[model samples]
Target: MTDDRPQGTFVLLDLDGTLVASAPGIVASLRHALHTLGRPAPAEATLDWVVGPPLRRSFETLLGEGGDVEAALALYRASYEAEGMFLSVPYPGIEDTLSALSEAGHRLFLCTAKPLPHARRIMAHLGLDAAFEGLYGATFDDRFDDKATLIAHILDERGLSARDGCMVGDREHDVLAARRNGMTALGVTWGYGGAAELAESGATRLCQSTGDLAGDVAALLRSETGTRAPVA
Candidate 1:
């Protein structure tokens, strides 16, 4: 059958939970920060929520009122830089999925809550940096921490229309941000968000596994008309 779906679709992918199993490193750094401050850190199992969101927001919660969030963040960054960032590895099938998408002519961009420099370094460490056309993310100064704003900034900077792009991630933040910017939201269950959170956030479609990601993304970017794709 002849394919009518658009080629060269702009895809924004999340870094932490979606592409890499980064919780181990992130939680450890967070623990280091808290421990440095003499604050008790939560158990690893309970800190999965910290993997995808902005660190400042997570630290704010971790530190509570009158807590030194800046100090905690500094310590966390120090730890992440020294060792924690190297602790992660990309998800299984992720490399193949990326290769398939790139070979099919899709343009991929890394859009994450992780700081831009760190995101780049991590991708380089994983040898996946070459797959992306650009890596856009948060800054220590708070710029682009909001997913919606980050998506908007990406659209503007790249001169790409919302109709030609899709945001792929494993979180409600990713889905909601895509919808807010009039783009399709493609959620992957293998990531930290799982099926429930993505569904609740009204994802255009959900890929139960990385095996289906490239196909789902291609289909969504092709037929979507700058409106939210029907939940599937």
Candidate 2:
């Protein structure tokens, strides 16, 4: 009883950890912000954990309970916007995957918890702005609290039905958002989230590598329609 899209279709994608790995720059910027504001930096190992969700929550986690969350958040933004975000870079092979998807007659859009400005900047920095027809994300006022809500907004903006599109990401948050919107959820293991997390998040399928995505996705969506043209 799973509803899926046709072979050549639009796919809403998550940014950080999914399409790119912006950890080094993000971690350094966050550390500088925390230090400047007299807060302890989150352990290095856990820095990338902050990439997937909204920045405010990442700041909150870094600040810990009873910490000056607001001040820390302000400092975090100052550093991140000024330079922290530029540290982000797209994962290798991503260009090919995106190009392949587009050339095959599928539309690509971005769906991320990252702020509109930051997401836009990162996309442009990575030469990815043109890869998508639409870039959907939250404003600075809202954080990455609810992926479902964001997905709903994206769907509304595009005048899309759940059966016409799919969601691709590397986190449980991404999968849950797709399911919440009744869209097909596809997970990638090369990003922050692993296979177990994706499965638990109710993803329709998993792509082990970035390259596996185009084919598996073609198959999954093709199966949905009971017929499909060659993806190439």
Candidate 3:
């Protein structure tokens, strides 16, 4: 039940695909941006990959090398702020899993590629803000657009070490970032990134459902701290 490690464990969670199914809002906003820029929007099915990566990078992929990524992002934000952001909803059993993790004494933090302000708004909208001790995200100007940079920032700002933490997300970016920072990566298959992607990205563990996720997290915490979790 109690952690034996000198420093308690922490978890960095991704926002879009991991916690919230934000593809609807994100895709709509992307479409809005493309329309505003006089570009043809791609088919809806093709946009699933857009949910986990940085907005600028996604826009760049759609708009090409010479595309005005900033402009598209600006337009996307305008629409997203007005009508699309709240179009998202949390994944099934996400709140319960988060509560269980928090109750188990592990510190949780939001670390996402989305802009900080937007990430805050999304969490507040979902009433999940209280579940996290802190939220670390990319800047509006895309300064920390990649998962590695955001994770590094969180570690530096909190005076935490990767050895005492892990990253849970649905994308390869998250797994790669965690590895790059010397932390374990937990991949969830219920999100956008499928099992193959997680496996190829070197996820320390792959969770098939909320129950699986919670169990893995508990096991990892116990393994790291050399203590057993309390039976539920």
**TM-score, every prediction:** 0.94, 0.88, 0.92
Residues 41-155 of candidate 3 have per-residue lDDT tens digits of 9988889999989888888889998999989989999999998999989999999999988887779999999999998998998899998999988988778898887888899
The CA lDDT at 221 in model 2 is 65
Worst lDDT 10-window in candidate 1? 223-232
- The parts of candidate 1 lying over 4 Å away from their true place are 1-5, 224-232
Worst 10 residues of 3 by lDDT: 223-232
Top candidate, metric TM-score: 1
Q: Candidates sorted by lDDT, descending order?
A: 1, 3, 2
lDDT of 1 by residue, 1-232 (tens): 9975456578999998889999999999999999989999999999999989899999899888999999999999999999999999999999999998888788999999899999999999999989999999999898999999999899999999887779999999999998888888889998888899999998888898788999988777766343654322
Q: Over 4 Å off in model 3, which ranges?
A: 1-7, 224-232
| Per-residue lDDT over 1-232 for candidate 2, one digit per residue giving the tens place of the 0 to 100 score | 8554345467898998889998887778778878987776778787767778776787777677887767776776788888888888888889999988887667888999887888898899889989799998887678434788898887787887777678899998898778777788889998888899888877788898878888866766655742112111
**What residue pairs clash in candidate 3, if any at all?**
none
Question: Is candidate 1 or 2 superior in lDDT?
Answer: 1
Please identify which of the two predictions, 1 or 3, would achieve the higher TM-score against the true structure: 1
